[model samples]
Structure formats: C-alpha cells, structure tokens
Target chain A: MSARRRLSLGERLVIAAPYLWIGAFFLAPMLLIAKISVSQSVLARPPYRPIFEPSDSLAAIWAKAQTFSFDAYRALMSDTLYLESYLSSLTIAAVSTLIALIIAYPFALAMARAPERLRPMLIGLAAAPFWTSFLIRVYAWIALLKDDGLINNALMALGLISAPLQMFATTGAVVVGIVYSYLPFMLLPLYAALERQDPSLREAAADLGASPAQVFLRVTLPLSREGVIAGALLVFIPAVGEFVIPDLLGGSETLMIGRTLWNDFFSNHDWPAASAAAIALVAVLMIPLLLWERARLADEDDAR
Target chain B: MSAPLLSIKGVSKKFGAVVALEEVSLDVGAGEFFALLGPSGCGKTTLMRCIAGFESPDAGTISLSVVDLSGVPPYRRPVNMMFQSYALFPHLNVFENIAFGLRRQGGTRDAIDARVGELLAMTQLSAFGHRRIDELSGGQKQRVALARALAPRPKMLLLDEPLAALDRKLREETQFQLKEIQRLTQTSFVIVTHDQDEALALADRIAVMRAGRVEQVAGPMEIYDRPATRFVAGFVGETNFIEGRLDRNGAAALVAEFGRIPCEPGDLPDGARATLSVRPERIGVAREGEGIAGFVENFVFRGETTLLRVRVARDIVLRAAACHGERHAIGDSVRLNFPPGAGTLLAEET
Candidate 1:
C-alpha cells in the first residue's frame, strides 16, 4: 500500500464524477440560457443562432457584430398580456399552495399520531398518486369536472341540479387541478416533519396546563413551521411553472404564464420573446428561490 | 392527621393482555414527599401516570381531596407530571413555558405575569426567562420543568425519574432541593424512581413495587431496617442473607445455626424456615482469637470504609464493613461477630 497507489485514479474519478455531471447538466445549461438571452433572434430558423463577432476592426465584423440589447426585456415589460398572465400564474400558484397546505396539515397530523402498525399504510396512501403518471391523473380530473361527466351526471341523476354544470375551462378548474396534482408533494414533507416531532412535547404542554387548542397553537404549529414552509415551497415553485393542467382543464379564461410562454416559443416561433419571458420569470422567482435555498441549507446544517 | 390530600384506591390498569398495575392502592399525606421505587418493569411510572390522569384504571378510582377523577383529562386533573425527558416545548421561551398552565386556566395577563414571576424566582431561574430551552443546561431545564409544574399549584405533583438524568453530585444536591421545595409548598409529591439512594434520601415514605404489585409500603427507615420480604430487603440495599431455621419456641430468643456460631435469630416464629438478613455495616470484624474464624477473600476500599468479604465455609461468603485506617488485607484470617438483634429474619419465598 504505497501512498501513490492508495490515491488511485479510479477512486478519485468516482468521487469527482457526480460534481462533473451536475456542472454539465445543470450549471452549463443555465449559463448557456443566460448567454442566449443577450443574443439577436434569427428569422425562419428552427433553432436560433448565437450572434458573436471575432473582432471589431473589419467592416464584415462590424456588420455581423453582436449588439447586446435590452430590447427583449423592454418587449416583455411592454406586453400587457404577458404581464397579466405572469401575475395570474403567480396568484394561482400561491392560492393553490395555501389550499394544499390547509388540507395537508391535518392529514399530516393524523398520520403522525396514527399507531405504528397503521402509519406506513397511511403514508403510502398519501404518496400513492406520485407513482402513476401525473398527466393521466390531470386528464382524469377533466372527466370528473366536465359537463355530462361524473360530477354533473351524478348531480342530474340525483336531481340536485336541473342541468349540467359548466365547470371545465374555468380558473377554478385550473386551481382544482393544480391543487389535486401537487397535494401529495405538500403532504409527504409535512408528514415527515410532524412524525419526527417528539410526542413528549405535547404531553409537556398539557402538564403545563395548556388546553388542547392552546397546545396546537403554541407548540404543535410552531414546531412544524419548517415543514410547512418546505411543503409550500415544494408545491408553489413547480405549480408556477406548470402548463399541462392549466392547458387541459382551463378554457380561454385561464391564461397562465407557463402556457403563454409555451405558445410564444412553439406557436409564435419567437425565441427572443420566449427567452425574455423565461428570464423575467426567473427574476420574479429569484427572491423566494434564494430564501428557499437558504432554508434548505439551514435544514442541512441542523441535520448535521 | 387530616385526610390524605391524594388517595388512590384499588387502582388496576391493564394494557390489552398485560396488566400494568393490579389493585394497587396508596395514600399521600399532605406535604409529604412520597416515592414509588422499583426496577424498570415495575408499575412505578404507571402509578404516577394513573394519578396524573394519563391513565385510567379499570377496577379502581382516584380522588383528590373529595373530587372523583374518573373522567378527568390530564389538563383538568388537579395534578401535574414532570416527565422523565423534561419535555420542554422547544418553541417557547422559559417565561412562556412556565406561563403555559396559567394562561390555560384563563388568568388575566397581570395575574399570569405575577404567577410566572413568582415561580421563576422560586426556582432560582429569574434570569433565564428569556433563554430558549435548548440553550439552558440540564439542571437549568430540570428547574424550569419543576417551576412549570408548580405554577398551577396543584394538589399533588408527580415526578417520573426526576433525578435519574443528573450526575451523582448534582443528583444528591437536587435531592435536597426537591425535599426543601416540597416542604415549602406543603404540596404532596409522588416521585417515581429506580435509584434506591434517591428513594431513601427524598422520600418520607416509599412504596417498593415489584412486577405491578406493591411489595411494601412504609417510611424510608422502616422499609430499610425491616424489609418485609426477601425481594424488598435485597432490592433496597446490599444485604447478606444466610439460610437458617428457627430453633427456639415461645418468647425466648429464637436461635439459628451458621457454619460455626449458633446464630440467635432476632425474633421470628419457631420451626419456620427463614433467611437472616444482616447489613454489611452491622457486622463487626473480630480479632483472630476472639470470635468465629474465617479467611478473608477480598477487601474493597471505598474511601471512607473498607468492605471485607470473608469465606466462613466452602461457598459461603459473609460481608463486613471496616472503616478506613483500621485496615484488613486480603488473604488475612479474620473472625466475624454479629451484635445482638443486628440481624432480621425474612420469610422464605413460596
């Protein structure tokens, strides 16, 4: 076991490969997007070309000189349709996250207090949706909410409603879809957090003379705040970028930034505008993203 | 004198097929510090929980003064428990933690503040009110737990292995503090502990338990001096049990035989099979020519005293304690003497 042999090339490569892969797939793509955001848009091309110049001296070079412009950002701000869609997406995401949290908290609490023999089964039930295709689940919601579908059919058959209800293609339908899709994401983390909490703390609160409501308010809620925050972040961040459910369940009344951005890139073939919108969305989410990252780091620190 | 402040009658609790407590009954007099001492599987904690209203007995009733606690929840019970973990709420500061009970009782802000302040001062924790529970030391947390439990001024306080978490020196010091607090408040306290020294030091009376049954319930000195059963005698302290049979009849002194000395049993029924229990400190080391002779097998030095294990016969070891500076080395021959009435005869287990 010589020192040089102990420091084997294969072991070092095995340790360094994960960082390399992360840099190539995640960091490199993000940097490339940043670079493309500043480039001139090409006309009638499937993929937009990057505008770069070798030198500034020659006439040809000057003709092809890449001009850095904030015009795309200016276009993004000026477009009222894009701005409203962005705001609507943010609102939908926030509202759905709140609703998901409201539903998940009690479910998580019940799961946490359930007996040991029943705990794994409940957790599996909460997580079972994630194992199936998300798209199919969202599509299933369309059948449940559409006119002459299950809900309307049952309502009419029971004489609860005189006619079929128009539920699909509304903002409410989009919210319902997003909440249903993302609810399990909120629940798992909340359950994990609540389950790890010591039951002794509640006993201590009771012994200290706290009523049941006071115990939940003072001890249970505060102790589970980290989990609540984490669950909210998990549900909100992805829902803000979600387009599938909104496109399927929502009618023309739903104009989320995700669907609009997709239409801008694929339908309109406006790469610069789409890239500009993506950059703006990133900028809009920067503060929360940073806070969430900080929270995650703090969680890691506490674990260590 | 007055009726017991807290009384438990025929308390029997079972968890499915396992019986945690079986017809257990005890009374805690006002201002008395009582202890339930037993090993891990014993019903000490179960009894404490039953009194704290965390457990309900299937065949008995618990009462405080004259109020029956049949359907009372823990929060409504006139008793509080200091859990073994010192289960402090990690989210609340010390002041809020101590004020928790008072707030629940619907006290006004000023009233809660005054009560919390008084309890803080009483527990010598006035300066620690702003500190987080995790920031405080173990002893500090213990004091905070004590103050929190005492804030409501319940009729009785239950402690579950209160001093088991402390180091030896701290445990001894806290034992005195606990006794003093109990005296000052004049509140009945039922402490559950497995440590015999803790039980003996802090208890006015101890209920020794074994396998969900009360083995003996008596004052500390009485329980120690005259343990009613072999298990009680062995569990409470170190003792040497010598097999013997009652030799005499009537009111005459009962005598039993050892290997050499015809050991006179202190006082027991004649013709009964018994085991004589003698504390190591009660046995005296005699000079080589004075008493029944034995070979010293080992001598363990314990700072203030030396314990000598003597071989009186094949496979028979007798223990005697000698004070420091009056030394006896291992491998030396020694004689053992039992002063009159120093031994207690325990009935043989069925």
Candidate 2:
C-alpha cells in the first residue's frame, strides 16, 4: 500500500503555477533591470557595457561584476531635476488620487444604493472606459484641453472667456487627465464595499437616534474604509508611474519622474540611468504597497 | 395598562402597486412585550419598520404620548430596533458599538463611558467590551446589538426577528433572556417574528398578521386555546379540523363524521357549514361504550408526546396527541372523545 501523503503531480503543478509566473515575469525582469542599472552606459550594441558574457569563467564573471559602478544612480542624486520630478510626480499623484476619491465616493454610493436591476448597468458604465485603448483616451483629453479645442471654444462661445484661456499643457490639465483615466479604478472597489454592506447597519444607526449626517459619519464612512483604501491604492500606484497622460496633456514646466525616465532612455540614450530611475520608482511605491498588504492581512485575521 | 405609550393609527403604506400595509392600527402600552407574528410577506416586518420610522406610512400618523409623529425622521423618533442580522459595527469594538448612540447624542466622555459600561453589564457582555465585533460569537453579537439599541434609552425598542440567526436551542435560551431584559428595562418592546413558538414564549400579547392585515391580536393562551379564525387556529398549533354542519339551531353542536360534538358557537346560521377546531391534546382514548369507536391507523413518538392518527366511521381521520407512555399500535381498536369545552366551532372560511 502507498503511503498516504505527498502531493500528486497535478496538484503540485497547480500550486506552483502562480509562483512560477511571478518569478519568471516579475522577479526576473526586476533582477535584469537591477543588473542593468549598475552597468556603464556607452554607445555600444545593447547601449550598455559590461555584459555578463556566457564564455567568461566564474571567477572572471565575479571580478567583472565587482567592477560595476553606481555612476547612474549617483548622477540621478546629484541632479535636482530628478529630485524635483520625483516630488512633483508624488504630489500630482497624491492630489489626483484624493480628487478621484472625493468624486468617486458619492458616485459609488449612488451605484451601491441603486435598485438591484440598475446595478449591473451602473457597473458596466464604470467599466466601459476599459473597452477603449488608454492611449486613445488620453489623446482625446488633449483635444478637449487644448486652447483651440472644444473646451476653450465652448467657453468663448458662451462668453465665459475672452481671448481663449491658456487651457492646454498645464498641471491642471495633467491632473484632469489622470483623474479621468483612473476614476473607474477608484469607483469599483468602493461600490463593492458599499454594496456588500448590509443596509440594516444604517437603519440600526438611525434607530439609535443618529441623524442622517451622524449616521453617515459614524457608520457609513468607517465601514467602507477598506474599499476607500483599496480604491486610493488602485488610483495612486498607477498615477505615480503614469507616462502617457503627462506626455500628451502636460506642459514642459510640469516635471514628472515618468517623463524624466523616458527622456533618459529615449532622448539621451542613458539606459543605465533610466533603469536606475525605474528602480527608484519601484522603491518609492513599495513602502505603501507593503503597508496596505499588512493592513489587509490584519483585517482578514480580525474578521476570522 | 394605562394610556398606550405608542399608538399607530390608520397607517397605510404601498410600494408602487403592491400594498405593504393596509390601515394597520396598534397600541403598545408602556413596558409591554408585544410581538408581531406572521408568515413571510404578511406585513409584520413592514409594520415593525413603520413603527421604527424606517418607512413612512402614506396615510396616517404614529403617536408617542399623544404627539403625532407624521414627519419625524427615524433619527428623530424615540425608538430603536435590534435588526434581524444584528448589524453590529464591524469596525468598532464592543464598547464603541454600544457607546455609538450615546456618543451621537453628545454625552460627556465620563457619562458615555458609564452608560456603555452599564449596558455591557446588563447584556452580560462586560468582558467582551474590548473585543472587536468580528471576534464575537453569534450570541455575543446579538447581545451587542441589543445593548447598542438600548443605550439611547428610547421610548420603545423594536426587534426584527432578534433570535432568527441562532440555532433552535440557542433561540429558546435567548427568548427567555430577552423577556427578562424587557422586564428589567421596563421599556415597551415590539418584536416581529415568523416563529410562532418564539412569539408564544416571549410576548405578553401577539398580533398575528396575514397579507398586510392583522388577523388577530391577543395573549398567548387566548391565541392558542381560543383562536379567532380558522387561519389563526391552524397557524399557531397542530389541530384536528372536522368539517361539519349545524344541525340543531341553539345548543352549539356540530354533526361531524365521528358524531355530534359540543362546541362554542361562532358566526354561523342554522344548517350552515362550519369547522370544529379541536386541539390534538383535547381528544383522548375513551371507553368503547362512551365515545366514537375507531382504529389507530398510525402513531409517531415525538419525544415528550406521542401523536396518533385514528380512522373513525366513514374513514374520517382524527389526530390525537397523547403522553409518551400511552402505547397504541397500528390497527389497535380505540375510541376517542372530546372533553367539554375542548373544541371551538369556527365559521367556514369563504
């Protein structure tokens, strides 16, 4: 008789699939980027030097790796442009996430409280933006924000402005673009949290002599906190690394780390510097992301 | 009871085309434990919600101490409800959940703490005050809900199937605890439940409802022993319904398949069809010469009581609930008789 233990091949394969996918797709690329970030940039075949050649001996490879420099990262630190860009990207992302949250919360509440029959349609509408290409959507924002475009024209026609206001290529325009694109991300989780809430909680609050505003403040806001955090993270993470929206709709004066990275990689051909910037961006994002995950685990434990 | 503390008058409500409540009126005296009992979709819950001010009636007024409560919102109303689901705040600890109503009323910190501590003791959840709501058991959560609803010191407390979430044994235990709490608080309680046993056990008076109307309202014993309608009789407990015709005009007797049986007179004309509703316990095995003869068709042992079905003359079956020690096998010859005043004659439902 066989011993009554050990996983079967199929079970092992199923269990290992997600880890393998993350290892191959995420960790491997990250390691490669880290390796490239430490290498010297030169006008060469791969645009970077000191490749870990297959023919090199183990000792030779180790010795060559030791010769790797922190020049790219050091250059980024020495320049205030990178620092300002990082700060600006963080600020813009924070502002946009807050705005999206404020705007999306009421809409999410409305969707959650909508009649059951209409809920599916409301969700479909929230998700409808994903059907179109994100690039096309950002480009469409440009047409509306430009001085000669629809918004300014409408303002002029309605006698709201004279000599067409400077509407395009501004920080405000970039914020609008990011908010427009990420509003759905901010809305869906909130709707899920609110919708799953038992309506009786509100009634129970009211029954306890809490006025409408007090009920909202005491019960509704605190209960949907999980969704609020989830929605904020969803919007903030991508907004921090957003490239296309700022490139299309923002002015030259509005500096973002994404645009800086793009310039390093494409315009200056500084592959190592761009890789360093990417790593820095990842490091900046990791702290909050880890905190959020820990909070989620703690919440699950409390629920159990 | 003195003048009713809460009076609901001519309250009618409709949801689109469907009538949820129809001119429902009820009076709840101070410190009375009242129950709205019915099957699902019988408007018991709707009536409770109306009283709680969650749903407004389209056409009438609810008064507390003779003050009309027409436009008062739920938050402004002097009432609180323990929801069927408990609805304990998942984000708050037991202490905060119980203290929420007091905090909303803007009490001083010390007063809030004292009140919450007192409620925690009252609900027997003093140790659980520090525990998160999600960490509590179902029974503990129910106590938290009860404590939270009672913290505001409302004029009336409403419970929507407060014990519906518990298992049978726990439900029975909670029913007694709930009654004790109501007595101790001296606050009028209006509970809505579909469970007849719960209503019978916990309530001082029960309003049995059907399809958006109150069918009968009376004490438990009255509802059980002397139901007003055929619906109430069948709905509350097990009974043997014997259809019969009124033969003689005045003595209040029914001529059924078994034989002529004495019954309480109802609203029925001479020679009109009626039903003799006799509780299963009222019928007993009698001597052959004294009562109608029948054979025991089958019997079921129900722990405390043994139920037997007897096939009498004309193949008519009558159910009798006897004590467990009374042994009767299938096909055993038996005679059944109804004790005087044991059965009631109800007019045949149209």
Best by DockQ: 2
In candidate 2, the residue pairs with backbone N, CA or C atoms under 3 Å apart (3 or more residues apart, or in different chains) clash, namely none
What lDDT, from 0 to 1, does candidate 1 have?
Answer: 0.85
Q: Kindly list the per-residue Cα lDDT of model 2 for residues A55-151, writing each as its tens digit.
A: 9999989888987899989988998999999999999999999999999999999999999999999999999999999999999988888889998
Q: Model 2 off-target regions past 4 Å?
A: A1-5, A43-47, A298-304, B247-251, B266-269, B303-305, B323-325
DockQ scores of the candidates: 0.51, 0.72
List the lowest-lDDT window of 10 residues for candidate 2 chain A.
A295-304
Best by TM-score: 2
What is every candidate's alpha-carbon RMSD to the true fold?
A: 3.8, 2.6
Candidate 1, A53-130: lDDT as tens digits:
565557665555456566677888899989898999999999999999999999999999999899999988998998
Q: Which ten residues in a row have the lowest lDDT in candidate 1 chain A?
A: A44-53
lDDT per residue as tens, model 1, B173-274 = 898899999998998889999999889999999999998899999999988888888889899988988876676654333343444234455565667777
Q: Return the lDDT, model 1, position B207.
A: 96
* Tens-digit per-residue lDDT, B1-350, candidate 2: 56799898888889999998888888889989999999999898888888888888998888988888888888888889899899888888999999888888887999999999999998899888889987888999999999999998989999999999998888888888999999999999999999899899999999999888888889999999988888899999998889999876666688887788887666677788998889989987853657778888999999898898988876689998877677888998888888778887788887
